[model samples]
Target: MNEWERLRHAMRATERPDAVLDLATVMREGRRLRTRRRVAGAGAATLAAGIAAVVVLVAVDASGSGGTAPTERPPPVAVAPPSVGVSPTSPEPTPPPTVARDVPPPKALGQVIDSGVRYGTDQRVYYLVRVSVPGAPKVTVGLAAGRRSPNGYLTTDLLVNDVEGADRSAGFHQIGYDERSSTTPVPTFGYFVGPAQRIIGTVDGQQVDARLARWSFDKNVVIFWFDPAELAPGKRLDGIIARDASGRRL
Candidate 1:
């Protein structure tokens, strides 16, 4: 208002308004004002654009450094151990078969025979040949192949199964072959001939007398010894007869 009023007053007081008014100077001032306004607007727009560019750059840098990209790597995968294979074991080998020895044929009474006996046991078989004499109390004679002794001797025994006889307490009457005594020679043959308690019999039509004696090992068993030469193969005593000590026929 001051500038406009002053200007109007100066214009009215002018002696030659047309001449006082400097058209060229007025035109130049108007141009200068327009230039100053244009310059001010350009400076404001430049400042605003610079500020927006700075904010955008700052956001871009922040996102690049800390927003999406991962700082730490993922954890490593764990590895497992390999599986072990098992092998099958074979069964143990079968044991070998055992062989059994053959038993000889029985040649006489008390001789051993084969009854399918095997080793590793106390098993045996013998021939059964017996004689029975008649008496008030019967007397029976039997034979058996005894067990082998630890000294490696096999003995044959003749026994009276029923009654006891003279030797009550004593050792063996004789040992045919003593394994303990190396100097004692083996006898070729032994004989047992006697009037044994008057017990007599007939064998092969010959009047054969028996020597009745009790076993030293078992005093209860009465016995009679026989010569192997007198017993032929496949021949046994027939028509047997006997008499006891008290003259009792048996």
Candidate 2:
């Protein structure tokens, strides 16, 4: 056989006898395959761009230089640790000293309750008298001083005026018997309406006894006095207190 026939024979042997070749169908399949390849390439390019964009964003975030400004975070707060052990308690407050309630027997106005000679003076005499104040609802007491003449005649002068609103219901009422002067030493005196057995006075941080007197007419009214000697210079009368038979302060 010639070379061309041999070549024809080889082609015929490679071709399937049962298969029918359709040129239109082959063209349609080739076009579809090419379209698929184009689509795949475009997808790969788009994915590469997206990956590049993500890499740039990561670099910017790590550098902390660009993109939307990072949200501002508030500073951390400081908290104190809990305390341990027992809590201290406050001390109780001391109550103010008060006097007992006692009513005195009623007396006529300007009536003398007690009388005594003034300390450090012979001619001067002091007297405690019950008196009534104008426009006041309760009766009050007063202290008066007088000088005695040789003929037994007496001239009187009111030393401390009666304090309005002072009565037997009060804890106690006090007045200075005489003013402190070069010639006369000041004596402190007062009266209380109670069953107090004794009167207490404070001088220079020490407790001292006060002379007490009770009138036969008004036994409920107790008169008390502190001598001028107890109130010397630099010594102050801090307070006055009355006590009952049981030693309880009234």
Candidate 3:
């Protein structure tokens, strides 16, 4: 067929509704043609370079056959692995909280809750717990006039041991009450003087049951707490009499 007729027939075929065309196909064809030309050009250039290199190598080989070719070669390039920065490790898991343990009660009654001898006072004021027969008349034995609470309220109910028996050079101190107790016990003539110890008081030549403990509020000072309720209902709450670890009365 003639070129004009063939062209007319191809156009009629492309004009059919099912034979759709778009700009994207045209652009893709253009890019493919350009890429092929570029590749062909590069291949021709490479061939020329290879031919030139071969000619130079032949000349060198003919010239060097009378001697020796240099054995030195360039070192191979090192390819490193893909780098990945290390993320900081998550913070250590938080630790659990601590729990408090239970403490046991004392075994002996009238045991000195706490006591200490200070050398600087003649008539020193010491905290004490006083206990005796319920109906027996209470006597003031060198008891202090009054000790106000820390909150500035005059404590009329404060039980103290007024030490009148000590000489001018020394004084004794103690406490036999738990300040944290819900119900207050009757103030007795006793105070904390040690961690745990026995207080031996004879009544009718028999031993009394009293317990004493020292609650350390800090390193330098401690409060004394005591329990005499374990004493026989009929047994008198004989005031706690403190003594040194050597068994000598303080």
Best by lDDT: 2
| lDDT of model 1, residue 200 | 35
Native-referenced Cα lDDT, model 2: 0.51
lDDT per residue for candidate 2 within 80-193, as digits (tens), equals 121121222222222122111111322223333223444233454445555556754354455444444445444443244334444454356644444433244435555667
Better of 1 and 2 by TM-score: 2
**What does candidate 3's lDDT look like per residue over 1-250, in tens digits?**
9999788666644543334579799999999998997788778767767776777678778784322222234598432121111211112211121111121221222212222221132111222223332232221221111223334322222333323221111223422232323122333333323322334433444444333333222211123222234333223333444343454444
Q: CA shift at 235, candidate 3, in angstroms? A: 6.4
TM-score of each: 0.24, 0.45, 0.24
Off by more than 4 A, model 3: 1-157, 161-189, 192-196, 215-226, 232-240, 246-250
Q: Report, for every candidate in turn, its global Cα lDDT versus the true structure.
A: 0.34, 0.51, 0.34
The local lDDT score (0 to 100) that residue 186 gets in candidate 1 is: 17
- The regions of model 1 sitting more than 4 angstroms off are 1-142, 146-152, 155-196, 216-220
lDDT of 1 at 103: 23
What ranking of all candidate models by TM-score puts the best one first?
2, 1, 3
* lDDT (Cα) of model 3: 0.34
Task: Quantify how close model 2 is to the true structure by its C-alpha RMSD in Å.
Answer: 52.3
